[model samples]
Target: MTHSTDSNQTLFERAKALIPGGVNSPVRAFRAVGGTPRFIQRAQGAYMWDANGRRYIDYIGSWGPMILGHGHPAVLEAVQKAALEGFSFGAPTEREVELAEEIIRHVPSMEMIRLVSSGTEAGMSAIRLARGATGRAKIIKFNGCYHGHADSLLVKAGSGLATFGHATSAGVPPEVVQHTLVLEYNDVAQLEEAFALHGKDVACVIMEPIAGNMNFVRAGVPFMRRARELCTQHGALLVIDEVMTGFRVALGGAQSLYAQQIPGFRPDLTVLGKVIGGGMPLAAFGGPRAIMEQLAPLGPVYQAGTLSGNPVATACGLATLREIARPGFYEALAARTRALTDGLTGAAQAAGVDFCADSEGGMFGFFLLPRLPQNYPEVLTTDGARFNRLFHGLLDGGVYIAPALYEAGFVSAAHSAQDVADTVALAREVFGKL
Candidate 1:
């Protein structure tokens, strides 16, 4: 129960001397919250143990891949069996075909699929395929819907709607981002204007159905329906980046939810990662036969990776898919997620704190504002200092959440009712202090 700061601080200092920012990922550095990052030694079920040997209920879920929680028995068994067979062959494997078939079965829109190593690679390749298929140069992306750190995608909104975005990263040249048009999330009017101006030149309109990076902002149903229409009318692909929402949202994904609301609703292409990998390094992109066939040996849009469709990763994914496919899996997960959100909302109300939250399936996000935000600029209006205090208080209470407020949190099947209750109790304590 006792946590020693020396162990974490010493490890962090040693890591900073060697690795950039003392972490492989920038967010793990805890720079936003101003604290020594916890050096996670191991994770099991819904709990993670830091290097200081303190346990905390984990809500990050390895950023949305651990839907069944860490080391689910079925997934572990499949991974172990596959590792015994081989790691990478660089040619092809039956497991890859099976994984592809499994994915295609769930996602009907994708007649074909290609596995990759990371979400960034999958997204980047999807954009290239979009460009090659349409023979166009421009792509439309929203400001807060992160489609990985791909150069064209890593862009901020330009001076005006008519102007394209500017590069947000240092190494990415301005020319690389000039073709990318960044729009506001859930803005149908701006979307219509952009399409009217450059419909002929746009290759694809890519977006996350629910923007996760800027917290959880659902792309308005009206906005999504209009986006599909605009893409169809302009001969541009409607690409949905489901890297974070794919299986985490539902059996069919966020697309399935949209389809229920909008008749015949579906994207031309879908880019996916996270839960599909089952905590391994794997991602995929696919669409209809004619379009997806545009990539690799079949077509001119060449893409290759030595580690693509890795044997062990595919096994892990296949196992995960099988487990989640069982009856009542998603229903149970959704109910548990609702419980957590409602509990937190109640706790905040009791403490007289302004709070709002939203969730879909097992994915959730909360804000200190009185109501949920709809776009990147609105999301930024949250008081960072106040959220940081809440972050530290949760950490102190042994309930782990994302270090930054902009990121969405995940709940796993491994999360017990007790864990949710304890988390709310902790939050209530913290809210009182706030």
Candidate 2:
């Protein structure tokens, strides 16, 4: 309970000796921001305490999983009861079926689902299913839209449209990504060109409804509509990567929002994670029954995980889903998120600091640019030095957001009006200095 002010630094130093870069996750190292990552000891609704016992208003929300915020009473009870009953069964349970039913009920696009342990696993499995069902070898992705670290997906855009993407990661070789084509996000012309070139051989086109990793640039409505049309025309599956937006953005995820804009729109395969697991390690991908049945004993595409449906993770996810399903949950969460962004925008305007922001449901993003960015190249234009100052300023003032500029921030149901007000007030001060 008692620790020195430098406890976080001390722990980081010790961990560096044992763990690579002293972090299990790359961003957690704060490499982009150039600071020691806070060693979190514990978290409670809308707040987290670090190793030095410093309490900060948590806006990250465990990178968009804690929608109802950390340790809700109902979620805690479900998890505790499930834990008492058992952990992983290495088999099926009633609760797993119940959770699947719940998700399908809300996300109509997913007629069936296969649960996994993380977003990466869900995305990887979805691509495989697409390839298997369609009997196609090529896949298409957009720049800055992260599906996972899957080898084929770990690719960057080539210099020209004709060439496929090159491997972004070291271990991922050229041949691995040869079938992967990466195009500029929200660029309808380029998308059409790609489909025109490789339509017949394309298995699927995967994308985030809102590219959260690129700091929340929306996939333009025209762009999304074209994607759906092209995929259908080409006999390629449309995979919506809603790992960050599922349940966090709305009951049906970001796809629901897009469907409203483009009537009767739906993805062929949907990848879900984050809030679905309620801060636990659980994710899933699903589609029509015929496509889903293509896996395992039913079909040729083989994928398996020992901890696919861990009892505790499903229990936590089910509990979280039930809570967010409540009436007015998202309406209230959206208002809070808007408040945070609006306040930041007003503060930046008053201080003459170039800034803009956008939000959807509980998820939000901001940039130190005069206008909101629409693509990865535009996102790169954000002032990194200024952002680092603002990040540290907020952290010092006991408000924590994502350490990296390119990541989205989250607002939870647990965040009070006062919490948003405090954050805005602190941000105003920081903006003046900037």
What's the lDDT for all of these models?
Answer: 0.91, 0.90
* Candidate 2 error regions (>4 Å): 157-167
lDDT of 2 by residue, 131-221 (tens): 9999999999988778888899877521111011232767877899999999889999998999889999999999999988877899999
Could you tally the backbone clashes for each prediction? 0, 0
Q: Candidate 1 — which residues are off by over 4 angstroms?
A: 1-5, 157-167
Clashing pairs in 2: none
Give the local distance difference test score of model 1.
Answer: 0.91
**After TM-score superposition, what is the CA distance of residue 279 in candidate 2 from its true location, in Å?**
0.5
Q: Write the per-residue lDDT of candidate 1 for residues 33-61, one digit (tens) a residue.
A: 88899999999999999988989999999
Candidate 2 has an lDDT of 0.90
Q: Supply the TM-score for candidate 2.
A: 0.97
